[model samples]
Target: TQLLEQSPQFLSIQEGENLTVYCNSSSVFSSLQWYRQEPGEGPVLLVTVVTGGEVKKLKRLTFQFGDARKDSSLHITAAQTGDTGLYLCADLTTSGTYKYIFGTGTRLKVLA
Candidate 1:
């Protein structure tokens, strides 16, 4: 079975603080994506880094794909209340059935 593990299942921080979340797996993936979901809404794609050691930045959020394609990380600089949400990492797999394996989501709360 393919699985992704994420750290810091929950986080709370004051506005303008920095935080980092990690996703790891024992299996290699062809691609990995990061998403942020707001209350009652589906996750919106934050970024997708397909190349190993690749990094992409969206405003204050930065995403990185591990060189081995088995892990990823998300870093937020100067986080704001608007950054509060559930962050998830997913990887597509073809183990019996083609599907995506999601990490144990991380809930972030940024206080104003």
Candidate 2:
């Protein structure tokens, strides 16, 4: 089973608000990826962190990987209603099938 854990099971905020989501695990991962899933559709990859202490940004979103490679976070600045969805973090394992075990997921709703 996937060992990743995500905090803030649900969130609701104003359109201009800021929010942060966390993903943690006891097991270290070779690579970690973040995805956003809208209703009735599969998740779309947001960012991928391969090295420890790595940080990547996409527009108003920032993603970081912990120094131990067992934790990660996603921070959104000036959130919009378009950001409403389920945010998932995934760990890339060595199972040779490129399998992804997703986090518990954070369901976010941004009100206009």
Candidate 3:
């Protein structure tokens, strides 16, 4: 079974602080993707990093895929209270069902 575990599962940070969240798996990922979900909403696709050692930045958020393809990371710079949400990492299933395997998720609370 393939599972992605995110470290520091819960984080509380003040505004303007930077933080990094990690996602790791025992098996190689097919498509390493990152997502964020606000309360009462579905997860939003943030980025899909396919190449090893690839880094993508969206505003103050940075997403990186591991060189070994077994891990990923999300870095948020200058976090704001609006950035508070549930952060998740996911990958597509190899079974051809197009199903997504998601991590347990990291709940981030950014205080103003």
Candidate 4:
């Protein structure tokens, strides 16, 4: 069974702080996506990395895909209260069971 596991299920930080979250899996993925969701709203795609050793950035956020294609990471620089939300990582599985398997999730609280 393919599964995506995320580290630091919860995080609390003050404004301007830096934080990093990790997503890991034993199985390789064709593509991986990161999303951020706010209360009562659907998740918004933050980044999608397909190739090994690929990296992408969005403003203060950075995303990296592992060379093995089985892991990924997200780093946030100068976090603000506006960054408070749930971060989710998803990997496409080949089993045809589900299109993607989402991480348990990370709840972030950025204090202003």
- Output the number of the TM-score-best candidate: 3
lDDT of 1 at 47: 81
Q: Compared with the true structure, what per-residue lDDT tens digits does model 4 show for residues 61-88?
A: 9999999999899999999999999999
Clashing residue pairs in candidate 3 are: none
The CA lDDT at 6 in model 2 is: 95
Regions more than 4 Å wrong, model 1:
none
- Error at 58, model 4, angstroms: 0.5
lDDT of 1 by residue, 16-94 (tens): 9999999998798767989899999999988888999999999999898889988889999999999999999988787
Model 2, position 98, has a per-residue lDDT of: 76
lDDT of 3 by residue, 45-89 (tens): 999989999999999999988999999999999999999999999
Better of 1 and 3 by lDDT: 3
Q: What is the lDDT of candidate 3?
A: 0.93
Query: Which parts of model 2 have CA positions greater than 4 angstroms off?
Result: 95-97
> Least lDDT summed over 10 consecutive residues: which range in candidate 2?
91-100
lDDT for model 1, on a 0 to 1 scale?
0.91
The residue pairs found clashing in candidate 4 are none
Those runs of model 3 whose alpha carbons end farther than 4 Å from true positions after fitting are none
Q: How many backbone clashes does every candidate have?
A: 0, 0, 0, 0
Local lDDT at 43 for model 4: 94
Q: What TM-score fits each model?
A: 0.95, 0.94, 0.96, 0.95
